[model samples]
Target: MPSMTVRNVPDEVHRAIRVRAAQHGRSVEAEMRHILESAVRPEGRIKLGSLLAEIGRKIRLTDEEIAIFKSVRDTTPARAACFE
Candidate 1:
């Protein structure tokens, strides 16, 4: 696992994190990790596949219509890239 060092946190902010950590029964480091995770990967985030499916539903695409793409799609193997 990777580690991080957060520098120059304000005294009040550090104190607040300590208090919050204690309240949540977690170490200050764990609390910081939780905070960072929540800030970045939020609960209500919309994924690409889900968004595309929602659009298809809104547009009322039938199963047979979607299946037509599979029938027409190329099944060729992709060529690998050469660095040389």
Candidate 2:
């Protein structure tokens, strides 16, 4: 796993983080990781797979249409573009 160094945090902010960590029964580092993860990837965000599934449901695709899609779909791994 990778690690990060955050420098020059204010004393008051650090204290708040310590208190919050204790409240959640986690170490300060774990609390910081949780906070950062939540900030970047919130719970209510729309995911691509869920959106596609919803669209399929709304359109009421039949079994034959789904079979056609599966038959024509490419299953091969995509090659990376060469920039050189």
Q: lDDT tens string, model 2, 1-84? A: 899999999999999999999999999999999999999997789999899889999999998998999899999999999999
Off by over 4 Å in 2: 46-75, 81-84
lDDT of 1 at 53: 88
Query: Alpha carbon lDDT of residue 72, candidate 1?
Result: 100
Tell me the spans in candidate 1 whose CA falls farther than 4 Å from its real position.
46-84
Cα lDDT listed for each candidate: 0.94, 0.96
Error of 1 at 35 (Å): 0.2
lDDT of 1 by residue, 26-82 (tens): 999999999999999967898998998899899999999889977998999999999
What lDDT score is found at residue 62 in candidate 2? 91
State, as a TM-score between 0 and 1, how close model 1 is to the true structure.
0.53
The candidate scoring highest on TM-score is 2
TM per prediction:
0.53, 0.56
Using lDDT, give the best candidate's number.
Answer: 2
